[model samples]
Structures are given as C-alpha cells and as structure tokens.
Target chain A: MALKPYIVNTGIITAIGNNTQQCKDALLSGKNNIGKPTHLKTHWESEIPVAEIKLSNKALADMAGVNEEWPRTALLSAVAVKEAWLPYAEIATGLRTGFFSANTVGGMDLTEGVYREFKETGTVSNISSVINHECGAITELVAKHFKIEDFVTTISTACSSSANSIMMAAQMIEAGMLDIAIAGGADSLSKFTLNGFNTLMILDRQSCQPFDNNRRGLNLGEGAGYVVLMNDKAMAQCNATAICTVSGYANANDAYHQTASSPDGIGNKLAMTQAISKAGIQPSDISYINLHGTGTANNDSSEGKAIEGVFSGNVPMASSTKSFTGHTLGASGGVEAVFSAIAIRDGVVFPNMRWETQMEDVNWKPVTELQTGIAIDHVLSNSFGFGGNCSSLVFSKS
Target chain B: MDIYIKGTGIISAAGDNSEGTFLHEPPTYDTDKLLSKEPNYTAYIQPMQLRRMSKAVRMGIGASRMAMQQAGVEKPDAMSLGTAMGCLQDTEHFLAKMVTQEEQMLTPTSFIQSTHNTVGGQIALLAGCYGHNLTYVHRGHSFEHAMINAQLYLNDHPTHNILVGGIDELTDSSLQVMKATGVYRKANSTEQILNTNEPGSLAGEGATFFVVDKNPSEGSLHIKGIGISTPEDTAAAAAQLDKFMQQQGLSNTDIDLVMSGWNGNSSGKEFYDNINERFSASSIAGFKHLSGEYATASAFGLGMTMEIVKHGAVPAHMLLNGKQPKALKNILLINSYGHYLSIWHITA
Candidate 1:
C-alpha cells in the first residue's frame, strides 16, 4: 500500500516574521517586510532594497541558543527546525526519521570575508570560518545542533531546492524508507549571491512587485522554512493532527536555456499538469496557488504564461508572498510551502503586496488584498530554478 | 522493482573509458591536485555548444552520452546528478570577476553555469529529455542520494530510462583553500599516500555516469542494495553495515570481495580498519590508492567495482589480502567519508 504523506508541523523565519503563525498573521494584517537593507553589509546596501531578516548574526545565534560561532544560514535553519520539530520531540526519538534540507550560499557569507582577508594578508586567522563553506556543511551543522543523527542530507538546485526536498521526502515516506521526514531549505544574504544576481541585472533597486505590468527585477532576501511530514502509520502512532496532505508533486526540465525560461513555459506547464494528475484532481479542484513570483521580468512573464496554460481561462485565486519576503533563492520553495499550508489551514488568500496593474502578456490578476473566509481545499505551489529546473507541489486539506 | 545497471561511463585519473578492469599504472602527481584526464569532448558536443560549457558540464554531458549510446538509449527519460562542489572553476571565475571588477560588466554565462544543477540540466537539454530532472548536492552521500533517487524514479515510472551520475572538479583556488584547511597532504606517490598517517589526504576529481532501468539487458549488473548512514564511531558504523547486509539477506561471509575507501588519511583509518576486520572472510581491495580522495570519490569506486564484477576478476594491485576470489558473484563496496558511511551490494 502506498503511504500518504501529511504535513503535521511547520516552521518558518522570513523577513516578515519568525514562525508559521507569525507569517500567517503578517499575511492577514497586510504587513510587508521588504525594505532597504540594514543588516547585510554590501556595496549596494544604500542603493538596493531587499527583504532582509531584521536581525544581526549575533542576535540570530542568541535566539537559536547556540554558543558556537555559526554562519547565518545554519543559524536560521536551526531556528526553523527547532520550531518545526517541537511537536514531535518525544516520538521522533525512536522513529525512522530523516532530515532533508536544501541550501545554497551555505557559508559564503562568512567565507567571503576570509577570502578577502587572505587576499590582503595572505593568511587566514580562523579555520572555522571556512569550515562550513560547502552547501552540505550548513545542513550538517544544523542537524548536529538539533541532535538529528538520521538520514541527514542537503540538496541544491537553485530556487527549487526545498520543493524538491519536500518531494523527495514524500517519495521516501511512500516507499516506506522513512516514517517521518523534516524537509526545508536555508540561505543567507552573501555578497557572492548578491553580486551574482546583480551581475545578471535582476536585482531591483526598489521593492519587487510580482506579476505586475511594470515589474523590473527581484529583491534578494534571506531566511529559512521547514515542514515536518509523516506517514499514516507514524501519524497514528504519534497521535498528531495533520495540517495538510502532500497530495502530489512533479519535476520537469525546461531544456530551453541556462538561465532563461522558454517563452511558452513548457516545463512549467508540464510540471503543473503532471502534479495535478498525480493528485488525481482536476484543474478546477485547485482553490489557490502560491506563485513562484520572483518579480523578475523573465520569471513573471514565463510563470504567468504557464499558469494560463495550466488553469486555462478560469484561473484559481493566486498570489506571490515574495512581495512580503523577497526572493529567498534556495529557501523560496520552503518559505512558499509553509505559506501554502497556512493558506490551506486558515482558508485565507495572502495579498500580493504592491501590485497595481496586470502583466502585459498574460491576462490574469493576483489577489491584491488579504482575502478571508474563503474555501481553500487544495493549494498548488510552483518553484522554478536556474538551468530550467521546474517543480510543482499540491497540498490538500487534511 | 529491480534496477539494473545497463551501461557505465567514467572519466578519471585512470582514463576516459570504462572498458578496462585495472589501472595499468598509478597516475603520477607531485602536487595535491589529481585532475581527470580529458577526453575528446568534441566527439560528443559541438564546438558551438562546447564554447559555453565549463569543465564540469563538458565532462558530465560527454559521460552521459557515452553511457546512453552504450545502453542503446537515444534519449533517457530522466536524469539525476550529484556533486559536492559544483562548477568550481566557473564559480571562482564569476566570484573573482565580481570582486575584481566591482560587480560591473559581467556576462550571465559564468553565473548561470555555476549552479549545481547545470550539469544535469545540460545533459537533459542535450538529450532533449524534458522528463524528471533532479540534482543532489549532499557532501559525501551525493552519489548515494542520486542512486537512491534513481531507484525511486524507476519504481514509480517503470518504463522510464534514467541517467544517474556524480561529477566534481578541482580548481586552483579551491585547491589553495583546501590546502590551507589541511585537507590535502604533502604526500606525492601512491606508496607515500598509503604510508602517510597524516591528518590530510590527497585530492582527486572525476565524472561517472550510469544508465539504469528496470529491464535487465544482456551483461547488465544487478544492484542488490545501497545503504548510507552517519554513525559516531566505527563500532556503530560496523553495526550499520551489518544491518544493511542483513536487510539484503547476505551475511558477511557471503561476500566474495570487499572494496574499501581508504585514502591514506588518519581521519578515517579506524573506520576502514573495522570494515577490513568485518569482511575478513572475503578478499579485500582498496581504490583510493588509485583514485585519490574526494566527496564523490566513491562514485568512481562503485564504477570500478561494477567493471570488476562484470569481468569476474580482481586486479593484483587492488587486493590488500588474498590473490583471487573463487568468484565475483557477490561483492560489497564500502566507503567512509568522515563520519558518513555508504555501503553498496552488487552481484554479477
């Protein structure tokens, strides 16, 4: 028998708030956290506006209750994982649990300083600074900090990373390889990633406006998000209440370009359609959508076209919460997944903050105001990445 | 569902092809860098397309093409790739240019290719495969995660042919940084590498791909099981290995040969020694003496093990104990990357 995976708990830390409930409250209150940078020290700090988490590295470490000096990515991951794992604290000890995290720019935020110092002084003062430089190193640190010693690993596929992590956990649970899986991703603001996005000319000077007529580019942000998924047997044994069921998920390659999506969004269309089929549902069954809206010219246009192709003329209510928490790169999928679960659980549609006009190419409009008392049974979330990696996930109410 | 390795391709310090059973001569190197021997990539990729690809992408596409051609698969239905440090050369290129030029006048090529999934995406694009595409970037378990994902994909989509691979490259800046971190030793030759009890190990890079499917073709090797864990000590690691073998219904004595990952480093010597003692009844072989050490070095080890099982023979230089095994029907391959241990069960 194939096991159905359910989201029993969730944790998230973004520019808007620090936990799932806080994020939901921020969404309900029409609070946007995108603003000029104050924490990240970069050359463009005064010029560009980003949705940065309003905390220093020291503050984050203190909040995470870690005495050792750690990178911002690992610190954020520890904070989110702790909140997500709180409910299953006792039962997880003897269960076949796994931790699957997605991360990019792992410790680059710290290593950049070390590299610069080495260039100037020709010597590294502390080896610990570069020890967590690898993408998996962040996951390893977070896992060890949380005392999660089973099946810990990391995934990196650009922005779609954590979506793939959740999908992989679902598959593993269905195959009986794991009873419960904690899946999410973390990425912190680093000059390497900031300059990388700036070189592509995709960093907006102003706050981003996703799916809008005059949308220019994205605002790079940093944070973490995670969800705890359990099989039916594990759920029963733990006597936990599920927030939603991870009904279906699919991944497809665009095969178009290295960084650009196709004009037709073929990969996006295929992923959404395949995921819908896997869930055994019709397009009309989808009640809401958490768009992968980075507000970049290419992403909005391509994802809008893909949305039109998937839902046809009558599209479901959709919004991009990235307006509240800028494009978080690798952590965007996990952030949006948590938002989708909240939308399903609370029956509310998050507003696409700062939207004025519809896109020129696609004929659709996002929900611009917080919608309450709506019936949201099934939610579809999309996360696309560089190299044309596209993924879609369907979360249904439990 | 049963997964079969239809074909394999590898580019390592040994050579570019996967037809041979032995490393004729150990690759000689004075420095810590053990770069892969380049093949004629023009045979697989066009010059126009090759101009934009980095070393990792070129090697990955070339290896996938060779494996697909040998497996009689024109286009695989899916692809899953693994890498610990992806496209390091391009990443360093972009990062240096960004810093040196003050983040001005930059092309998107380097930044785009620097992503970890670029290699797998390139393989899918070249093969025109729009099916499932995934990339795993776990540290030492990267290849193992890719293999496990391949198995799940085959189980879910039984008719789909999958291309699974692990690719990593060594660059100058990365080498400098790693050497500073004391990950690369000053040892030179294979003999010195084995004799060294230093804290650091040698560095190597390679790209290896396999065409996997549910249908068993002629001369295809059957994959028995794959298990990965991160235990605190060698005793726990040995217990994990035992549990994995027992899950596959095989005892330690049922193994004809044992392939271990022992890179002349004192960091993981105890773990390897424990494995050596556990598989005492079987012929023991080591590969890191030839392949050097890297996060995905075990991928190259697994490829070589498959070749050995296919030929039913073990090279004299690889054996640490006996001359020959009665038969290479069942072989156990184990690798310990720091605290992580990966076990693979393969049979002819």
Candidate 2:
C-alpha cells in the first residue's frame, strides 16, 4: 500500500467562531458574522469592512497561553496549533514531528507600529519588538510553545501558503522523512495587507459576493487553521481517530501576471486536474469542492473556467466559503482544509453566502444553502495567491 | 535515487560563478557587510522590467537563468526556493510608504513585489513554467529545507528537472534593524571570522540556484543527504549528524572535509572544536569569513564547495586545520545559526 498522510486532527479560529465546533455550528446555521471590525486600528475601519475575530491581542494571548508581546500572527498560529496538537499531545514521543506553517504578513502588525515610532524618535526602548519580523520567527514562536523541534519552517507563497505547507507535510511523510506534521498557516489583519489589497483595488467595501457575476472583490479576514498529519507507522503508535487523509495536492504557477489570474485559467486548470489525477480518481468522483473564490472578478472567472475545464460541464457540488469567513490570505488554505476534513467526517457541505448570480464565464451556480445527508467521500479544496501561486488539495474520508 | 546537481549558479559577494566573473568587486573579506555582486541583469531581463525589480528579485532571476542555461533546461518542472526574510527591500519600501503616507495613496508596485515567493513566481513567469512552486522561510535551514524538498521531488519523478535555490538581500534598513537588534556587529569584527572576538556575526546576503535531477549529467555533483536539527530537541547536533551519516551508509571517518559555519562568535568556539575532534580525519574549512553570515549563507557555502568539487581541491585560505584532502570526494557541510544545525552530505 502507498504511504498516506492521514489527518488526525484539525483546529481553527476564524470570524465565525474560535474553535472547530463553534465554526461548524455557524456553518450549519448559515451564520456569517462578517461585518465591521471592532479591534483592528485602521483609519478605514468604518469605510471598509472585515471579518475579524472579536478578540483582543491580550485575550488571544490568554487563549494561547503565550505572551501578548508576540506578533499577532504568531499568537493566532500558536492558538490554532495548540488546539490541533492537544489530542496528539505526547503520542508523538517516538515519532519525527514537524511543524510546517505559513503566513504572508509575518510580524508587520507590530513591526509597522514599531517602525513608525522608530522613524519618528530615531530610538526606541526595545528592539525585540521587530525581532519577530521574519516569517520563520512566527513558526519558531509556536514551535517553542509546543516543543516540536524535529523540523520547522514557514511557507510564504502569498494566499496559497498554508496549502503548500500541508502539501509539503504530506510529501515529507510519503518520503519517509517525517512521521507526523502539524501543517497550516495564520495571518492577522494589519494596515500593511489591508492597504496593499486596497491599493490593488481588490478590497470590497461591503460583504463579498463570491461567484456572483456582479462581484467586485474580497473582504480580508484574519485567523489561523492547522491539521495533524500522521503516517501509518505514527498512527499505529498513537491513539487518535483519523479525520481524513490528505489524498492529493498540486502547486502550479500561473506564469501570467504577478497578482492577476489568467483569463483562460491555465494554471488553475492544471492545479485541479493534477490534484484529481494524483488522487487516482475521476473528476466526477469528487463529491464537493471548496472554491478559492476571493470574490474578485479575475479569480471567480478564472477559477470558474478552470472548474468547467476540469469537470467538462458536469460540475460537482462546490461553494466558496470565503463568503462566510472572507479571504483570510495565508490562513485560507488551512482554515478551508479544516472545513474539508469536517465535511468528510460529518458528511456535509457548507453554503456560499451572498452568491447571488452566476458568472458569465462559466455555466455553474455555487451551493447557496447548508447541505446535509450527503456522501462527501472526497473533498477538493483550492487556494490561489498573488504572483500567480495556485494550489489545490484533495481530502478523502479515512 | 541519487540526487545530482546538474548545474549551479550564484550571485553573491564572491560573484556569479556561472558567468565566469568572480571577485569582480573589491573583496568583502574585512567588512561587516557582504552584499552580493550582481551581474548585468539586462542580459537576462528587459531593462524596463528590471527597473521595477528589487535587489532580491533581480539576483534570483539572474542566478536562476544562469543555472537554467547551464543545465540546458529552459523550463523546469518545479521551483523551490528558500528565503529567510524574503524581499526585504520591497517590504521596507511598502512599509515606509504606508507609514509616511499615512496608509493612503499607496502604490501597488512595491506591495505586489514584496511577497516572499515573488522571486520564484517571477522565475516561473520568465520560464512560462506552470509547475510546482514553493518558498521555505526557516531561519538557518531555509536552503537546506528547499534541497530536501527537491530531493523528495526527484525521488518521486526521477526525470524531472527542478530549479532549487535560496536568497536573502541585505537592504540598508534591514541592516540597520539587525544592528539595532544586536544580530549584526556594532563595530568592525576580526577579518579572520573564525578567530574573531566579536559579539555578533556580520550580515551578508546573496542568491544561489541549482538545477538538480535524479540522473547525472556532465560534471554532476551528488547530494547524499540533507537534514536539519533543532536546538530544542533532546538529541545533540552530533547525534543528528551521526544518525544522518548512518542513514547514508557512512561514518564520520569517511568524511573527507567538513565545511563549518562558525559564526565568528567565541561562544560557539567550543562547539566547533568538538565538531573538529569528531571528524578527526576530515579537513575543517570555514567560509563565513568569505561569504559573511546570513540565513542562507550555507547555500553560499554549498556553492563554494561545488566550486571546490569542480576544481578538485579546497582553497588554501578556506582550510582551517588540515591541508586540502587528496580525493575531495565525501564532504559534510554543518551550518549553524544559534544552536540550530543543518547537515548536507555531498559527494563528487
């Protein structure tokens, strides 16, 4: 038998809820608590909306049991990973453990603030404030908290980062290098990313309308998500139930534009087709798809076209959960992966909220209502990013 | 499957070896900063396109192109790059504008180019490659982790050509920040970095790329293994290396050379000394003095070791303890940042 990366556990902290069960309840009840932010200190707070977790940094630290002085990205990552590792705690005693994380912003939330003060004063009392500025430092913070030292690294491929992190963990497990891996990503709302997206004209002022022809752009959200992947040997050594198997994954580049998707969705098509092919299944075998719908015109059109290409018009039940959580950037992959796992485990699919119209480019409509009593044997998840970094992952019920 | 390096390219303080222009700049032998000596990027990228690129992207593109040309591969099956603090120049650019402009009227150019994977993405764009792309951002093991991924890719697809590398750029603001954080030296350290009394290591930066595959080509260099050890682990770094060596069907005595990443801090002198004693038969060489120090400096160390493999002898200045090994076949590269270590087993 081929080596498989079985997902043993998952954890998440999004706007809809703080834990997996809470988020599941929200998804089941069709609740999208995305609105104006009450915490993020942005001048456009009232003008542009976001899907922010209603917790202060101190509160998040209290949840993570770490210092509040750490970067918000790290804080978010530690909380999610801690939850993910809770069940598998010391079961990994004899296993080679790894932590593969992802994040785009690093510590810019704190760095930007410290930098402004440093520029104005030419001096600051503390310089360690910016010490966690590197993406690796975020991983380090969480790794130290958990004592996972066999391997540690962060992938920063924009939005598809956490997806790639999960993929690498699977690959390493298959390569017989690691026995277990906690893979995912985290990103906190910051002036840097918010303003950057604003300049790109991709930040929707109101709630996002994914897969709708009249869609403008995406609403930026903040949170973290993680999954515990274990090989068969590690599974034999541990006492945990398998949630799902990381069946297949592919990371393909657009090679078209730095931050825009190709009109033909060549890279998107490759990602979807290759992932399905790697899973050794036909396109129709997939029961549901978690779309990478960022509500942007380019993303929806290109992604829809790619879906059409992959399924040949017989589209599977698919929906973009971004309407519920907004576009979480680096954290989107992990957050959605957790959803995919839960979907397969519980036999359900969440709805894409505010998906009012069909995109003219493709002939399909996303699932708009909560679904139950369905066989979600295989779930495909997509995560694409700027610089044309595109990735898709397939999860199957274990 | 034996992972082999088909071609190598680098843009660094030492210069671009594939372009046959090394030591063009005044050597940064006695300085606290060792910046890469970039080639004329017009040869690889358009002048207009090059104008919009940051220092990191330019070097990444330049080095990857040279590597592709040398390997006779126009499009690779995948690109895996490791950058510790990726695209720092553009990151600082966007951060500066956001702070000074009060978060309004920010241009998207710098922000667009500020992503950690921009260099890898740009390389894909130039090659029109729609293959696997990844960027690892660990502190010291960044490049090693990339190589590990490439090895796994080669293990799965033996015929696939993969472009793998690491990059880090030393921007002015980044250097200033490092100095303030005491990660960089406040004053001039010893030119002889190995014997230095300095408190902090120098900050250096560069980009190095390699086209690797399962099958060997002309003058191919083989990678026996690449593994990393974290300080938080209960096992010692020596145990990690010994276990890796055992997996590769070798022992400490089989290693002909040990290229150590001694970061010029006397606090680590005892550690390197212990390493020197363990590999008693191997020649100990230091490269931080030549390449300075950075997260991916080990990649530069690998680059220099590849050069030695091509020339069939280690440089005299690099050798710290023993004379150049006669056979230069088995080599071990131990890169350390703090107590984190990455061991690369190489063969000619």
Candidate 3:
C-alpha cells in the first residue's frame, strides 16, 4: 500500500469555540457567532457583521502564555498549535519535522496601529511594533515557540493557503524529507483585511447564508486551525494514533480573474476531480464535501456548477460551514480541513447554517440540517481563494 | 529523480534576462536600495493584467514568461514561487490607504495584489496551467523551500516541467521602515558592497525564474542536491553542511567552485568566516557584490552558478579567493543569513 499521511492530532479556535469538540457541538446545534464587531475598530463596524472572536489581544496572549506585545495572529496560532502539539510533544522531539503555516494578513493587525501613528506623527514611536509586519513572522514566531527548527515555511494563497500548506506537508513527508509535519494557518481580524473585503463588496451585512439564492457575500471571520500529520513509520515510531488519513489533495488555478472564479467553474471542477482521482477513488467515494461557499453569489453558482460538472448530478452530501464560522480567509482552509477530518473520524456531516432556498441556476442544494450516523469514509473539502487559486483535499477514515 | 535546470530568467540590478548584458556591465547603486532594471512589461503582460499587478508581480510574471519561452515549453505542469516580503509595494499601498482613509472608501486593487501568492497565482492564470501551485514566504529560505517543493513534486511526477522562482520588491515606505530599524546601509555602491565594513548591508530586490524538469534539456545543468537549515550557531551549521555533502556523496574536492552570499555586513561575518575556512580546497566566489543583497539572492546566485557551469569559466570580478576553477564540474551555492543556511549543488 502507498504511504498514507494521517492526521494524528488537531487544534482549532474560531468564533464558534476554542477547541474541536466545542466547534463540533456548535455546528450540530446550528449556532453561529457572526455578529456586530466588539473589537475590530473599522468604520464599517456598524454596517457589516463579522464572526470576530470575542477576545482581546491581551486575553489571547494570556491564554497562549505569551507577552501581550505579540501580534494577535501569532498569539492565536500559538494557542492552536499548542493544543495540536501537546499530544505529540514526546514524539515530535528529535524528529525531522516541518511546519507549514498559511496566512494572508500576517501581523497587520498590530502594524496598522503603529503605521497610522507614524503617518500622522511622521515617526513610529516604537520600531519594534512593526517588527512582525511580514507574513512569515507568524510562522517564525510559532515555530520558535515550539522549538521546531527542522523545516518551516509560510504559505499565502488567500483562502486556500492552509489547504495548500497541508498538501505540501503531506508531499514532503511522502518524499522522505520530513517524518512529521504540522500544517495549518492562522489569521486575526484586522482593519486591513476587513476593509479590503469591504471594498470588494464581499462583506455581508448579516450572517452569511452560503449556497442560498439570496446570499449576498461573506462575513469576514478570524481564527487559527492546525493538524499534526505523520507517515506510517513516524506514527509507529512515535506511537501516535491516527485521527484520519490525508488521502489526496490537488491545487489548480481558475485563470479567470484576480478575485473571481470563472463562470464555467473549470478550476473548481479540475481541483475536485483531480483530488478525488489522486485519492485513488471515484467521485462517488467522497461521502461529504465541505464546500468553499463564502455565501457570495458568484461562488455559490460557480462552485455549485462545478460540483454538478464533476459529480454528474449524483453529488454527495455537502455543506458550507462558513455560514457557522464566517469566512476566515487564509485560515478557512485549515479550519475546514479539521472539520473534514472530524467528519471522517466521527461519521458526522455538519450542517450548512442559515440556508433557506437553493439557487435556481444550480442543480444541487447543500445539506441544511445536522446529519449524524453517516458512513463518511472519505470527506472532500474545497478552498478557493483570490487570484483564482483553488485547492481541494480528501480526508479518509484510517 | 534527476532534476535539470532547463531554462532561466532573471531581472535584477545586474540587468534583464541575458547573461551577457548582466555579466558585462552590472548596474551600480549608490542608494541604500538597489532597484531592478525593468523591461517592457507590455511584452509579457497585457493591459488589463498590468493595471492591477504590483512591481513584484510584474517582475515575477516577466521572469516566468521568459523562462517558459527559453525552455520552449508552452505550459508547465506546476508553478511554485517564493517571496519574503511579498508584494511590499502593494502591501504598503493598501496599508497606507487603510490608515489614511480610516478603512473607508478604499479600492480593492492594491488589496487583491498584496497577497504573497499573487505572483504564483498570476503566473498560473497567464499560462492557464495550474497543476500544483505553492508560494513560500520564509525569510531567507523562501526560494530554497520552493526549490525543495519543486524537487518533491518532480519526484512524484517524473515527466513534468515546473516553473519555480523567487521574487521580492523594494518600496519606499518599506525601505524607510527598514532604515528606522537599521537594516540597510545608507551610503554604499555596488563596488563597495563587499568591503563596506558597515553594520547593515544594502537592500536589493529582483525576481529569478527557472524551468526545472526531469529530463535534461540541451545545454541544461543538473541539480545534484539542495538543502536548507536554520542552525543555532556555526558548529551546528557546519555539521548540517557536512551531513548534506555526505548525503550527496560529495566532498570538498568534488566541488569546483563555491558561491557565497557574502553581503557586506558585520552580522554575517561569522557564517562567512566559517564557510571560508571550511571550503579552502574549492574556488570561493561571491555574487551579492554584483546583485546586492536580498532574501532570495540565492536565486540570483543559482542563475550565476548555472552560467559558470555552462561556460566552464568564472568571471574574475566574482572571485573572492583562489583562481578561477580549471574546469567547472560542480558548483555549490552557499548562502547564510544570520542563523539560516541554504545550499544548492549544481553540476554539468
């Protein structure tokens, strides 16, 4: 048998909750955290609702046991990675490990404050505030925090960033470059990203209704999610228990627009088809799909059509969890990957929150109710991002 | 899996894609930041695409196109890229607007272009080929990591050509911020880059793309090995280098030349000193003196190494110690930035 990369552990903190169990419970309860922002100080606070985690930077720092000066993104990453790493701490040491973090607005939440001060005052008060301004700073911070010095890198492919990170880690491990890999992404709410999405008219005013005909746009959310991956040898050597196998993954570009998917959904179709094929399984084998439904009209119709094209109207059960957690951008892939793994591990299909009507242009409607007792042998998750970057992954029960 | 450097495209302070133009008369920068010598981007990018692309994206696209053209390949099976700062020009533009405008009435152009993967995404979009797309953003190891990914991908699919590259651009605000942090030398020329004896090295930016394939194209060089490590100190770094060489079945005498990223700075002196002492049997050379210093300078160094490997000769200006090698068979491009070390062994 081919060497299979398994998800040995997972960690997540989102608007829904701080751990996998809490988030899973909330998903089944059909509860959402999307609401008016209490912290992110943007002018559109009154106009747009976000799924902001109800915690300050100081509070998160305290939770992560770090100084409050660390960027919220890094702090959130630390919290999530700590949870994921604790179980494998003994085996992780002295192993050829690699950490691949996915993030877009890295450290911007902190740098923007200092930058605004400098723009007005003509000098930054403390240069250290902007030290972590780049995207790799969070990865560096998290890697150092865990003392993981084997291999580390950051990926920033917009919404698909973390999914690609997960894919890269599996590829590296399969190539014998790393024995174990920690793959995921983190992003914190910031005026930069919020306003950026707002400018594109993609920020919904209320809770996002993904896959619904009346869906307007996405509700920007923030958090971090990670998974520990190990091959068979590493698993046996470390005595780590497998959560689920990272069966297959593929990344493709739409080549359509910078921020929009193609009308034909060619890239989305290719990603799903290729991922299913690489899993050495047929499309019918995908038990559930965590759709990249950001509640936008373009995304729903395009992705819906792509599913139709690839699955041939016999599409399996699917839902867009973004309705519950909001669109987390770079971290969305990691968050949804965790959900997919859990779906395969626990045999549950999480619901697509706040869906009423299906689109007229599409042939299938997403699962709107909490599903249980489903034999979810394989779960396919899709994460499409800006610049036409799209990725899909298959998580199978070990 | 045997990986070959089928083609190369580079845009830096040295010049555009041609090695002749870059090696003959390299541009000298008196400013703290050495900017790239741009080509007519309209040749590679259309107007609609050009309107939204940042300088980094444009450079990345231009270099990738030239590389694909040189390799005579219409569509690569995959595209991988690395950028340490990643669209800094657009990032600063969007951040400045977000601050000045108080996050209101901002345009989405800069925001869409600010992502680190914009270049890789754009390259795929331009080519309409997206097999496995990835972008690495680890400080000094960005390009090295991307190359590593390319090798792994080739190992899986042995009959695929991959476009791999590194790109980063310098912006005014970014330079100013670095200046405030004391990361760039204020007054330095390209000639003084090696002997500045300064506290900080001059900042520079460019993009270099390569077409890597399993089958060796005509006149292409083979990549024998690649390794990247973040060591605690000089001792750990030396051990890692030794292990890397041993894994490749190579010794000091087997390497004909050693290209070191010896940027003129006191911070990197210890690492350079260790390299100079360790590689006494090889012809030591330097390239940051001509291309300046940047996070992905190793990409430029790779381009330079390929040129030397193809010609079997090394230019006198790049020689740091020992005469030019009698016959260039294998060249090791070694780059160290603080605690990070990247090694690439190129053989013809």
After superposition, the stretches of candidate 1 with alpha carbons farther than 4 Å from their true spots are A120-122, B18-22
| Alpha-carbon runs more than 4 Å astray in model 2 | B21-30, B187-190, B232-235
lDDT of 2 at A179: 93
- lDDT per residue for candidate 2 within A1-398, as digits (tens), equals 55899999898999998989998999999888778889888878998999999999999999989999999999899889888997777667879999999999999998988787877777656776888999999999899899987888889999999999999999988878789999999999998999999999998989999999999899999999999999888888887778899999998999999999999898898998898888988999999999999999999999999899899989999999999898999999999999999999999989999877777778999999889988899999999988789999999988
The backbone clash count of each candidate, in order, is 0, 1, 0
- The superposed Cα distance between candidate 1 and the true structure at residue B252, in angstroms, equals 2.7
Best by DockQ: 2
What docking grade applies to model 2? high
Q: Kindly list the per-residue Cα lDDT of model 1 for residues A110-214, writing each as its tens digit.
A: 877777666667667997887888898888888887777667878898889999999999999988889999998999888788888887888888988899999
Tell me the DockQ of each model, to 2 decimals: 0.73, 0.81, 0.74
Ranking of all predicted structures according to lDDT, beginning with the best and ending with the worst: 2, 3, 1
lDDT of 2 by residue, B273-346 (tens): 78888887788888777666788888888877887787777767678886677578898888887666888888
Give the Å shift of residue A321 in candidate 2: 0.5
lDDT of each: 0.85, 0.87, 0.85
Chain A TM-scores, all candidates? Answer: 0.98, 0.98, 0.98
- Candidate 2 overall Cα lDDT vs. reference? 0.87
